[model samples]
Target: MKTKELLFGACLCMFTACNMPEKGMDVDVYEALDYCDAQVQRTLTELKAAEGTIDYSMMPRNIMDSLNTWHCRKATKDEWCSGFWPGVLWYDYEYTGKATIKEEAEKFTEPLKFLSQIPAYDHDLGFLIFCSYGNGYRLTHNPEYKQVILDTADSLATLFRPRVGTILSWPRNIEMFGGHNTIMDNMINLEMLFWAAKNGGNPYLADIAVSHADKTMKYQFRPDYTSYHVAVYDTLTGDFIKGVTHQGYADNTMWARGQAWAIYGYTVVYRETLDPRYLDFVQKVTDVYLERLPEDYVPYWDFDDPNIPNVPRDASAASVTASALLELSTYLPGKKGEEYKNAAIKMLASLSSDKYQCGKSKPAFLLHSTGHLPNNSEIDAAIIYADYYYIEALVRLKNLIENKAVI
Candidate 1:
């Protein structure tokens, strides 16, 4: 009898050990905030030094790596990534209340005012204008910022084709994407439209956002909820052409960031519209995302990439997912909510570690983000949007801990 009891006890111990959470899974919010603060200060110092050396003739594009050296580039106002830098500064100021950060935010934002007047720009107006001016209006309630946001929303709404029932993402002039290409990334831009309608813009702007989301819902996803990176449509006939994974491994494969965008986008849509369909959609997508995540809670650039364990991970996707999951937790009930919250916590813990978070030596905060891996572009590098969403996630977590309202 004694021998049998000993064996049973040993088996129970093994089961308990197997169920333990990974290291860094239980992150302290205070510590995470401290880490973010230090990183932001380091990034500020790096930017100050860069201002003297890097030419900002056009606008700050991204931190580029050449022969292991990182530098910024000047890009056109229509560049998709133009707003991320200013948006980062605004976020830092929001979190730390640092006047220096606020001053820099205003300085960077000044150049982007012209974007609001250019209606011919593509679907990136939200990433270009809203991330900067939308956050500005949220914090300061500045009337000028509000006007720019309203104008940009109107400009973005112009891209919506009633026949296609979706906003055109890439212009027809871009030969690669054809005339009417819509991408999963465009879902992130809808927040600006939702905000515009809620504030002062036309209600039809919100309708446009809903229509685009509904169309994406109908056409962009596969049977298992993994999404295609791009969907092509005939502009004149409003006919479905084909769905392709332009940045992914193949047409049927899942791009990590594209899936992240779908999950985050639907969560925001549900937040704004309170439509049960959006919530259900978010749950389905989130389930697939959580199940496919690596042991570290980070995901490879492409889920279908044959490389599997050897591929580059996209920390940006993880950051975006973590932020979305935090909001999603609030909307869900009981075990489901706790499960998502825990998953987000695990992702944050992994992202905050030395492997993913950049040190003071680097200009950017988050590292190992894979952007366009198939194109051999920006692979395993620091991306500004990654840092933006990381900080945003941390702030949201902190707010949740403090029982404050989270946006």
Candidate 2:
């Protein structure tokens, strides 16, 4: 009887230990502890340096507007680009376990909600709701945050054009129809819908989400495996436009960010559907992306365009690509999956190797981010999203290797 009780206790201990995640694989978490500590120290130093809180709002609105205009400014606060950092910071808090980032993130979230209150529902609401409210719910299990996610998902579903069989990019402005029938980054929103179905028991959201993926595979993807940033279709006639361009070189050029979206987006689709098309899309895109990557393992902002002399490289794009590759690797088969996993691992390694990364004390960030054209204010600054995704990729890799998951 004594021997049996001891044996049972030992087995229980082993089972509990097996369920816990292993340490040391998550380098970003360790690094971020130091980084966020340094940031908190510096921010406190700056606060001390300021004699008083200077009222920037007292300055004329024209000056404030002019200051903002010199950069890649979005027309509205609710557009997708505006939500990127909030999402990234949300990830940062999860990785680092720092309360300061969460506090700063809360400050950022209030303004986003203020903007969303006018409630311009579009393709990007998922970005905001998922990052701000969804993440908040994940961390705090706050019912208010969960409601925010549900309401935002409802807003997003309304943007679905039954004609195009996908969500419209813009809900209020018809002029912003560049993304009319385009199934680009909007695919990422499916996760929000999928969560809705599972959590709120709304299967309609999940059904439409999968249907959108199918429609995207049919229309936006090219034979060469490239994806369109904006696949404009006639809202009235439902006809295809031969070529289109939004932020890239031509309508045909593969914008690196859009490719990142497809790579990650399709992987999410595969997770739910287990549909072969999503898997095929992942394989084809990863193959092309890996082939075209620069010697540093980071890619240019646009994969198809020739390298312009002295043009800035987009580290943010590289970060996004790395993140997507990490996610896509999980769905691949056998040795093929290992290859994809190795490629993502290589990219993350190269990013951390100092050739492409920022030095430790700028305090602004730690990635080589590029934005807009040369004339833009944020043209070559290290962006927060780059840091966010780079850390996310590292954490994801840690999870896969340590968990002994197939990827």
TM-score of each: 0.89, 0.78
Candidate 1 stretches greater than 4 Å from native: 1-24, 49-70, 172-175
Model 2 per-residue lDDT at 57: 11
What are the per-residue Cα lDDT tens digits for candidate 1 across 253-371? 98999999999999999999999999999999889888988899999998889978888899999999999999999999788987888899899989988888676546577778888
Please tell me which predicted candidate would have the highest lDDT against the true structure. Answer: 1
lDDT values, one for every candidate: 0.82, 0.62
| Model 2 lDDT, residue 298, Cα | 69
- List model 2 lDDT by residue over 126-152, tens digit each: 765675666667876877667667767
